[model samples]
Target: MSTDGRSASDSTTASALESASFVRLVTKADGDGLAASGLVARALAARGTPFQVTVGRTVATRTERAQATTGGDGDLTLVVGSTDATNATRLDTDDRPATLAAVDHVRDLGETPDLVLALAGLVAAGVEPGAGESEWLIETARERGLVERRPGVAIPTADPVDGLAHSTRVSAPWSGDVDATHETLSDAIGADLEAETDRADDADASGTTLEHTDHRALGSVVALDAVSAEAATAAAAESIQRVLKPYATPDAPFETVGGYADVLEATAQTEPGTGAALAMGHDAREPALAVWREYGRRAHNALEAASTGRYDGLFVVGIDDGPVEAVAALSTAFRSPEPLVLAVGAGEAALATREGTLPPLEGVARDLESVLEGTGDATDQGVTYDVTASGRRGYLQYDPAVDETTIIETVREYQ
Candidate 1:
């Protein structure tokens, strides 16, 4: 019979039986039992047999309840759980001498199972089957014409101390010297037993050799124990400044390209210039100074060199009305080797202006300072500046620097 409790009509029956879903018996999350359950599921799948497998902590009262519910419809149910003999015995609800006796109760309920696969440890731990019980199980199998014994197949052997082993040398029963029937039953059971054995071995191997590694190593950057956040920040800042210095010039022009006005505003806060720094509104505008600083730093090295001397010509041209002009200004200002900044301040006109030539760095820087000081609004915004020197280009990005309390206050306000 196949695992679905149907008679075999072809050689494939054995395969079908092997693949049919069966109840998995496990004990305490035993790896062996889990693997065995998987093997059983795979075997059923291979044979195109319909089956369902359930897993649980132990073959206890809960498992029995599940089995009663799921097994009545002739569906195979495998329970995997802890395999302690005492625990198994306590869980058995059947009157038979051992936990395997539950098999008979299931069959008696008009559902004859194709097989009963008990994990070795579970069987070893359960109550021993008495002689009467053994004979009764075999007789039931014979009367039902289900093979109880087959030659050349290694049936589960009980340790001498095991009650079931002493009671029965189990075998599949079939009538009339039917070689095919014997072969079918033997092959089916043998495959299942072998798979279980293999799984158990694999579990043992894994337990013995497995090693654990940090999961974060898969993607995160590792830092040395000695590294501190402040130190790292300083290092990064130093590197950026070094890169920026080469492209710096004393007198660079600020172009009216690429929203150069904003760049000018940013530079005014950070970059020193010949002219008095322009003041911005201190109320809501103070927070935005960081943005201006970033823009200045980034475009600082790209300023176009203008007139030299203590009157270094660094200019910042703001496109308060024309966008095209702003972009062009920014582009030109950024191409210089001095601090030429630009600020394309808020307004539609600024965005509409056409591109224009860059001015000197001193003029750009001066204008930047003017705009930053001129606008009193302090809002946090990101600003970007690009610098190129000796064919190498880099970016300087800035965000408003604030303390934890200020950030928390901002977040709470938003919330």
Candidate 2:
């Protein structure tokens, strides 16, 4: 079924699948990086390849170091989002050494990989193929005749739902059950291809549920309990790989965080009681408490309204801490039948609420404005307010309900 001219049971498929590994990098937290990661992951998943993905600066730095010392072990490394690839070791121009010292190191131990698939952006930005410190890499690949270039291929890089749908159509496994599942998901969420696609490629902008879902699904598979704009993209992609594995005919081993919608829905169904509150905090001292108070007020009102028996009796639990602690409190509080919980703060609040850290108040207002006005680009202005000498006390006031645009615009102007 593949170019290797071997049956599925033959070692060819297994070898191809096993010999591949992935390393992802993003130039920034923009739509392009998200789309690229989604597309590449989909391709690898369809081919039954094993991979590991990492994003952000710290992860990227570690990945580069590992690859340089690992030697060329039949692995296909995909680096995404290399805005400035000057310091990259695997790429070279002329006088540079291109040797991936890590790959080379691993090769000496008899673990040579078959291919190295560097994302195009990274390739374009890295040390121009054999100039400065990259000469070693270019020359080595040339000597081994292993530098094969494949161009003009545009993979369908979109959100998880779109990418998965495309992959299902192209790969050998197509089923009515899968189609029905997709249709059900789309209809349940009122999602159309064009709209979902737009949300997926929505630049650095933010969106509501629909927009957030598409964006999140593109990056990773996520469990319903873990819902945050930051984590959704990655979670969705991860989920697709997991759901598809059981049907892979050969029964490939796959894992993914389950969906979170069910959890939210289930929590909403519980009777209102002394539940916990989840809040958001930015500066941790002044604004964090203010935000928590607002969240508490809103959550309490929502819960109370729902408790009227016209809807499910969900309670609100309030948490005042950093994002991490907030998420933890949310997780802990949700286990009981608390009436309401408000999580506030940065790290603690994020943990308690189970929603990633709340964006800065100004950023949140800007994002909300973008959603309401149907514009994708909203300027983010750093908040500046008078604070005590201890930096532990300050006053921040922005009405989320009134003149949201003006407030954000003012912040931007001052910034």
Candidate 3:
């Protein structure tokens, strides 16, 4: 039972998928692809996610990613061959690289998983991915087949096979042999699904198969832009609830009789991720999550098959989330070396820095290092700004104070 006097799994198993949490991506900059990176940062800004587009080898080791990809059009590339790129330990230390490269050379193209994994790695570092960046990463992750991406959730797993097994199963209905009929249909569907995975070169590669048998009716569900997973599951579960009558036995108490099998990325021989079993204690909750998981698996399988046994979408996923909106995210990155200027408020003041550049003048912060390198004076929007140097830092003293919160909020629509 739960603290709310309900089965704990009720929330886990019965609840339908609502909006899921995702991270706003952040990475150590290798001083390359500033234009592309700037574009991506700007894109985030347009969606209310301001980012500071700065350059440095913040990623513990540059060797972690084979080729670093900026968040923009594919033309930009950052190859890390510097002395700092010496460690293979960090890259191989996590399960990300291996899982992302599951199918040898065919899968890990364009550093797609690198970008996704970088964000995942940041979660352990106390940073959260903003809604805009999180959603983009999730959608891209799904498109690349590195993880299951659905409307509200995404999972980049170590094992695609175990990562993708989601099933909603039930007990045998005593009425007409629904269990028997379900098994027959399941077998047929499994075979067809397997056929979908038949590859040209890897004759040994098997087809994708349904995971369960017996009293389960696998409902085919599609993701609607506005509809949540919970809604879909609750709507789908109605058919099952009508089949079983009320029975109150402690050994086999009375309530909803189904749950979704845990979906994960595991090798064939291993079990799927934890808590994937079909059986659940009697309770009344939504079934949308399980359904969504199943659908996520289906989408991955479909993409995998279409990619000629290689998950090709990985390259395209990153690109689709790019360019225009990305340029907008650039405004958030204005960094004036020093805290630039300070905005005053009641008992508090917010410091504002130049993102990368201010509109129409998008240049890599470091590239224009000389601007903050020596003293300068400039005017725009009726305000003249003066800069003075402090060690490697620079200070901005501008006339007519700007509201920090208001400046941050107003600058978000840059794209």
Candidate 4:
């Protein structure tokens, strides 16, 4: 149950979905959103219910579109990937990941157990599988085909070459460099690459069945190399454990469920339309894969090129190119004990805490507004802001004259 004492069971959501003449699944374009949409689609299909799925940027936009289409009639609308809902049923699991709740929704609707969907939800959720509800979910997925009981080194694919080449957790020199990745893997694990690739190829040729033992052992070795390739901070160890066990489905485009989620996230960051299509079960793999690979390459380059400086309890990074949002997260994942402040271009900055222990940005924004006399944009994790002599439209407006260092120091003072 949630801390609010709300039941996690999908009985109510299932009943609502079953009785509605038509359903609309509104989700974000991210990995979790896509996974949630797919799960809902499956459940509705099993129930023989008609539904339409759409992707949006925020809860308001998603529900607004749903309402516009449904005309505020009898159609039921469900919001996924976010806790906030308006005139719709929210399918998020304790604000963790919507996919978990979606999995339960499918079963509640009497759909048969789907191993791939369950495994994907677990991977996307990125929570410990030993926990109460997660434990039950993982056990069911394992009974069907899940290989590992817990998360290991998160190299998304069974093929070490492909996985390492696309890994952003590790820095350059090996990331996006297939030869370097291969050499690193060969030196670290000393495995027979030819034989292993042959086996993986055979598995792909015959079917999508994963070689459980081989994947487990190989994933460990690759994970070790990934840690060594980057600074071996405590955050590196924590990030290493973020990888879910690799599982595959013949119906999906990627080899492992981890790979599927990875690519989806990458595509979401780069080519959102393709990402949404792939999430909604559209046939756009080739273009999506291209975008995912390029996104990985650019993200690695950005991380490598970022200039890092230290404050008392903050590590600030400045990125001149590439995806600032994604790099901010990557920097946080590899951060030290100090919180990370990402300086995006010259106008705005974002702050992130290790493991997201930072309190809501609302209070911070309020304090900053009083002190700096500027506007601030707050999110659950961090804030986007710039100090203006006079607040523009009561919102923080970027002033290029105000340097990033000033913003970082102001944010730190409030923290």
Candidate 5:
């Protein structure tokens, strides 16, 4: 084994997949998981390997493990990006299959262990990248126009109106309020906001979209709004402008990879099956986009109505009913100095922190698991815990039996 937990060399190849009668691919329901699993499924198909994709929380349960192995002999189960899984062909750092051992090497080189890197490893293993192929997933995505390297605002869509209205990043007070959105846009862009919208509409009608200059102009106004917001910190506002790699394509469901990730994440918030279908490259784009838009509205509205209490190192926002993941993610656009803990009644809560925060959330979540009588795992710089004691077995779900006050106190203690 090499430093950073990867084997120094790999001998695994497509032969492992080719010999299998069937392949079951399993991964988390989040964006990276979906993208990685989908790419793997595509590669498996290209190799004539029959495969089915399954998505779940970060950790695979005992039942999931059992089902993963239920296929007849000669069938293979491939698990990707799960924290703790067994009885399968593990492609993550834990078991360090040669197929993905390079993931650690890439990590050691300071790159993310994302879908593209996963594909790069697979490509090295003689797996074809499907028709119209390239050796690397990034190259393939670029060749197919699945992603463009143009830098722009982090908003997934080009339309300033829709971007502002549905954006979780800017955390504009007008979120989910169309009139408020229009008013804010008018304030930032002057009467030009209406003219720009009309022009964009005309462009859409003419099969020509707005220019990059127009996007940058609108993005500038958004940057100003974020910097000027009282709730925003300098660091957070800086992060907003820093995320310039706007990944999008007209052929894809959402405007950008960020956008697609948003929609997939929101869909997974309540409907894992729907999220998994979209993630596995199934033709579920329209319904998934619809789910994201609706989820955005509810989550933003919840953020607006939340009863916020600021602590030394945490901000507790209590909401009635909304997607906990959405609430946590959207609220981060404002860039609070402290991590945000959002609670839904006493039955559900999530802790969301900006990436690279202190007291790494995995440790924090493990600590809270004991106190909350719950099981939790770190996903996207934060943790989602379900209070198993309450008999709930879903993401962001805790037990009302734990009570609201105790949850708050426990979080406070851990924070």
Candidate 6:
């Protein structure tokens, strides 16, 4: 990118980079008053362009100011606050001189730009407009070689967490020996847990249910028919984890380029999980970020749904490896009241909850691990929730006719 107001890329990357869309930072006060950027932001997003807000000029937060002012390639910061000469002068830069309003550019073709909400927000913030202030403001900026028309900038794409990704999110990382675990869970939950593995994935209603990609093993279990609730939950968890953990792609370690663990580590909004493999590298980069975004987005959706009473709770898994990042969505009917979704990585037990963030406390994780080993119920402690499915018996029938969609659906129900 050049120092001139117009952003230009290197010769090798220009053409592809030109397709990247930048941001027009907006403020809450003036944001509701403007229309162009919201429309433009949607247009860009429809085509896969990424945009985010960074508070540059605001009276609200100190942290926001520090982060926004140092904005770079993809950000075009606009402060909708006080516009006294000193404030305005502080906002002046080669690319993003602060403006009291959003500038309207010719969306269709080459033409000059138009300024919107000129000094309106500034007045609201108590900056009195002088005689001929608006015109004079534009004139002085023009003299300083700054124009109201801002160009689109390029977004940074090589992060696991920033943009679109292709990696799949796996809810149950390993569903090992589906049958054995199914029988064990059946005895554990004391009810005939639904055999979710029937490969009924035929799109044309072929009814083929077996799928190799996603090993969605079992569905749900109930304590109603259980002879011994504690024993059932323990059996179910042991049987499932015993098979699933060893079945993971042993060739791809957690830190490997396309490994699910690596993607999780890179794109994670908070710190890495405590169970993160010690030998794994923290630096994991992919060419695109679609996978990470989808995973995080799904996780966020699951969290919000439970919190908002959209659903009582949810249990599911996601697994992705490059090529347009895979996503697993959960519907309302399949949610669980007490979800026990766990994230598995390299033989470690790391759980993330609203209260317990990633890299859960070692002692807490150990205690929960023990609880899962016993009856599946305990008090919530730190980040680990009480294990709800322990020693539970359920039935899962696996067959060869399963398809991708079916497998995904089964996994959600099982979790």
On lDDT, the candidate that comes out on top is 4
Task: For candidate 2, give the lDDT of residue 135.
Answer: 49
Q: Between the candidate structures 4 and 6, which one is better when assessed by lDDT? A: 4
**Model 5 ranges off by over 4 Å:** 1-15, 58-69, 94-146, 190-213, 242-245, 248-251, 333-335, 339-346, 355-396, 412-415
lDDT of 1 by residue, 34-141 (tens): 223333343444445564433332223334445354343334333333222331212122222222322333343334332212212122212121233334433443
TM-score, prediction 4: 0.74
Q: What is the descending TM-score order?
A: 4, 5, 2, 6, 1, 3
lDDT of 2 by residue, 264-301 (tens): 11111121010001000012222222232233233323
- lDDT tens digits by residue: candidate 4, 300-368: 777677788877766777766665545655666664446554445444444455633443344544554
Model 4 C-alpha lDDT versus the unseen true structure: 0.57
Q: Candidate 3: TM-score?
A: 0.18
Cα RMSD of predicted structure 6: 22.6
Give me candidate 1's TM-score against the actual structure: 0.18
TM-score of each candidate structure, all chains considered together:
0.18, 0.20, 0.18, 0.74, 0.71, 0.19
On lDDT, who's better, 1 or 3? 1
Stretches of candidate 3 off by over 4 Å are 1-133, 139-184, 187-196, 199-415
lDDT of 5 by residue, 136-247 (tens): 4556567766557555554445455655566554565566765676666666545344434322533221111234235555566666666777666655575565444455
Error of 1 at 134 (Å): 3.4
Better of 4 and 5 by lDDT: 4
Q: On TM-score, who's better, 5 or 6?
A: 5
- Model 3 RMSD in angstroms: 24.3
Q: Using lDDT as the measure, name the better of candidate 2 and candidate 3.
A: 2
Q: Higher-lDDT candidate among 5 and 6? A: 5
Off by over 4 Å in 1: 1-51, 57-91, 94-101, 115-132, 141-415
The best-first sequence of candidates by lDDT reads 4, 5, 2, 6, 1, 3
Error of 4 at 244 (Å): 8.1
Q: Scored by CA lDDT, what does every candidate get?
A: 0.25, 0.27, 0.23, 0.57, 0.53, 0.26
Give me the candidate number with maximum TM-score. 4
**Clash count, predicted structure 4:** 1
* Predicted structure 6, TM vs. truth: 0.19
